[model samples]
Target: MEHGIVTFLTDYGIDGPALARAVEERGLDGLFLTEHTHIPTSRETPWPNGPDLPRHYSHTLDPFVALGAMAAVTERITLGTAVSLILQHNPIGLAKAVASVDHIAGGRVELGVGPGWNREEMANHGIDPRTRTARMLEHIAAMRAIWENDEAEFHGRFVDFDPIWSWPKPVRVPPVLIGGEGPTVLDRVLSHGDGWMPRRAGLDEIDALAARITELQTRAADAGRGHMLVTVFGVRPDAKELAAYADAGVDGVLFTLPAEGPDTVLPLLDEWAALVA
Candidate 1:
């Protein structure tokens, strides 16, 4: 079980470098940061998780910039974007940013991506919300091409770019984890993503979740690929819950940390460290 944690950091929270150092010292695998380029105020799309949108959604820091700062300060702990909204940014530029951070982190970066749920938020980036899934897949393919080939190009309905040279190529291509839940998510992960990152509640039906994972792993084996990683996000830091996940063959569980100052955040980190230990 690779134990990790993700924190939604506000401006007033412990800065990225300090947070990274604190986690690394505790021997945690990594620290993930969440992103929201900007949250539109129109409220055109209903909040997916609750009655109200959380304040962190509107004020979170740029994951790439924060990860870069974290990378400079910490050597062992990995850094990642828990779920970057791929549909909200130009894939070419986003690819560059990811590679740059991976380089800075010495190859310790996980690129977790999602087709965002907010219609108005997608519109802000000139993306049609309805076409987001298709666009997200193409964007990922285009980014992979950029990372793998010396001179890469991709032409697709949503993302089209000519052969071009981009540099400071990543020390290693970062693993792409697809984040979502539904009947089709596993198929998508098998097709492109290196792993699956489902929110905790998505796995509430344990029997079905286990069966799905088994089926997905079988599919991966048939396709001549290694087993797909099952990582559950926002897991409560409880022993029995974690043991259940481990028993279910989950590769990792990411605990959520409050976006607060070190005074509040550090104690939680200590608790998480002991939990994982």
Candidate 2:
């Protein structure tokens, strides 16, 4: 099994280019960046982890642009968005950005997507929280059509577009990992996404997590989706925890890096490198 790291990059935090270089140099599987266009002011939606959302949510840099910068400085290491909020983006434009990044990185891109948790945030992008799941599915389908075809079009209740052209259609259609632990998420992954990224906080036990993956795999088999991989995120930086995930048949375990400058982050990265070593 492979393991990766996800980090929130900001103007005030880690050196993105340097960290990417080290990730490749150290032989880590991949480095995924987190995203948030902007955090809305309304407090209608409480933070998923706690009562108050962390400051990093508002300060996180745009993953696509940041990852593009990282791609310009390094190669070999997989660079990806841990979970892009697709429900808030224009699918066509987002597709172009994704394709551009994938082309720049020579196909080392993973498009992990989610219909975010913040109602106020979704409202800022004119996305109704209630229909976000439907919109997200349509958004992904539309992006796929754009990625795999010269002349593409997608018609759905949430996303309806006529024939259009998008250039630099990725070196390869990047693998998509759907993020969330909703009741219908497995179905969505089997339908459109190439993998599933479930946060560790959502599953109560490793045994249960393994059971869920077994069920997903069985369902995927029934649906003729044999390539549906599993990557568990927000995992503790403990070897025992990682070993349990590996035993659970998780394809990858994503560790969260602290939001800090290189002086702080590099040492942490080195620590992680040694842990994996």
Candidate 3:
């Protein structure tokens, strides 16, 4: 299975170019950055992982800009978003940014997208959290139209546009990986995504996760969509667990890295590199 790293590239963490270079030099297959445009200070929406939000949530650098910098410094590693919050950005503008970065990266871009968890954050973007799934899907469809056609147009409940011209189409349409572990996520993946990216909760969840992957693939095959890639996000560098995932037909695993400086981060990269090797 392909091994990769995922991290929140915060203002205080190891910078993108350096981190990308380190990942590539150590023979990792990909480097994926997390995204959070900004955090709402209301503190009303509870964090999914814990009581307090990590410092990186508000401090993250823009994923596309960081990925662009990473692209300039690296040659072989895939550059991607772990999960870009799709409902927060204008589809046309987001499409342009992704395509421009994909062009700069020579098509080495994978866009993992999700309807994010923060209610206040969505509210700040004028998005109703209840309708976010539909909006996210529409955003993706609109972006796909923009990427695939010379004069693209889309008419949807959330996104509507007359035929319009956009420049520097991606070297290819970057594969859209649907991100989330919700029960309905597989349905979304089969309908709109090139791949499925689910966060593995723990080593204990591997068997159940494998069964879900099988179900996803079988359903895709039945629908005539061949081989949906399954990438487990937030994995740890555990050999036995990785082998189990490989046996279960996962295409890739992205291990999480803490938002830390080189002294703390580089050694962990070395440890992960040993596993990759």
Q: Cα RMSD to native, each candidate?
A: 1.3, 1.5, 0.9
Predicted structure with the largest lDDT when compared to the true one:
3
- Model 2 alpha-carbon miss at residue 232, Å: 1.1
Highest-TM-score candidate: 3
Model 1, position 70, has a per-residue lDDT of: 89
Per-residue lDDT tens digits of candidate 1, residues 1-277? 8888888877877887888999999988888888888888887688877889988888788889989888999888778877888778888898999999999889999888889888888888888888999899888999999999999999999888799898778899888889998889998999989999888843366667677778889999999999788877888898888887887888888899898899998999899899888
Candidate 1 scores a C-alpha RMSD against the true structure in Å of: 1.3
Q: What is the lDDT of candidate 2?
A: 0.86
Global lDDT of model 1: 0.86
- Please list the residue runs of candidate 2 whose C-alpha ends up more than 4 Å from where it truly belongs after superposition: 201-204
- Model 1 residue 163 CA deviation (Å) reads 0.9
lDDT scores of the candidates, listed in order: 0.86, 0.86, 0.92
Give the residue spans of candidate 1 off by over 4 A.
202-204
Error of 3 at 133 (Å): 0.8
How would you order the candidates by TM-score, starting with the best? Answer: 3, 1, 2
lDDT by residue (1-277, candidate 2, tens digit) is 7878898887788778888887888778889988888997776787877897888889988899888888898878888888999888899999999999999999999988888888888888887889988898899999999999999999999888999999999999989999988787888888889999998843348888888899889988887767578987778778888888888889988889888887887787778788888
Q: Would you list the clashing residue pairs of candidate 2?
A: none
